[model samples]
Target: MDVDFTFRKPIDVSVILSTLLDAGMRSSTEGREVAYLVDEDGMFEWRTAAEYQLNEVMRELGDPRWNDRVVGMTLFFAEAETGGDFLFHPGRESMSCVVGINPKLFQGSSRFCDIGWYLANLVPLLEPLGLSEIEARDSP
Candidate 1:
């Protein structure tokens, strides 16, 4: 499934990165689940809030189509072995959680459900961090 969420107010890239990192850290401590930063070379590396440079990452991994606009910033955060990924594009005011391949190629996978559950709980956490007017969309 293709899950998309939009925040109420425009958020800074640095703030978004920090919030996600904080969430990752909390999840890690709780032993629930943690997200990793997937780079352009498909490397899944764990990064802390201080390690992320939004501009640098965007330039290295972001889609060229969005290069001209701030909206091109794309950060892929995936849960280990879940086949789930949260694609954060702060510039677009949206984040997408996807599992397996696109709907056109596959019906959907268990990973989708796993990520769905993760995102469901995450939304609440994000609200306290400054996200509001949250809206979710899933592909049929």
Candidate 2:
């Protein structure tokens, strides 16, 4: 579940990341998700790099227990375990909309959250990052 929000001002997702981490919202994050184009199909066909940056081998191997797939992109400011897997748009600037990935599987896990939640909760948290520009809260 991705919650899209229209921001009144330019926003750099990386800055949001740093701010959240600094606030202990996320335990840690070293860098952005390492993306690898997995295919050219109708799908987005990309996967974040594994621990060894081995997106190819890991995808090929397809072993679940390996913990090698960078589970929800281990390096991201993703709280997959807490239903706050906020997606990062690397290098994006001046975007009118940003989707906040939210899963409704309960806070102890990944996926759906919203503008109601995104704005009310995230806006304040992001103020220190010099942004609180979300214009309105609505479901897409």
Candidate 3:
């Protein structure tokens, strides 16, 4: 499912990284491993808190397609075991995050564009992660 949620404000980069790490740990405890996406290459290095400088990675992965609106934004985080990715956008007004499922995993009539099922599975997982302020919406 395609879901979008924004932070209440422009939160600190450290906080964002910490939150993502915490989520990954929690998922691991539940048998679902999550990791930060390093690059499009096969290099899937698991990073430690001390190893990452969010701003640096953001700069390296900046997407110009956003027209400078989301400078330093990066779509470089994903589940290590599963096949989904997270895109983080630190906009001037707020910060947004997206979680998407890999389409290649589905096929034939089973391939559906609607993200209702994905949202249903994700909302509860994120609720306890101190993201209550996030306003989430399902995109078409």
> Among all windows of ten consecutive residues in candidate 1, which has the lowest summed lDDT?
67-76
Measured against the true structure, the TM-scores of the candidates, in listed sequence, are 0.44, 0.39, 0.39
Q: How many backbone clashes does candidate 1 have?
A: 0
- Candidate 2 segments exceeding 4 Å error: 27-43, 49-80, 88-118, 128-140
lDDT of 1 by residue, 2-52 (tens): 556677654444455556545552223223333345343344354433233
Cα RMSD for candidates in order: 8.6, 10.5, 8.7
Cα misplacement distance, residue 87 of candidate 3 (Å): 3.2
Q: For each candidate in the order shown, give its overall lDDT on alpha carbons.
A: 0.45, 0.39, 0.40
Q: lDDT by residue for model 2 over 85-138, one digit each (tens)?
A: 443232222222234333323344343344354455465666554553345433
Clashes of each: 0, 7, 0
Q: Comparing candidate 1 with candidate 2, which one achieves the higher TM-score? A: 1
Model 1 misplaced stretches (Cα beyond 4 Å): 25-80, 83-85, 88-91, 101-112, 133-140
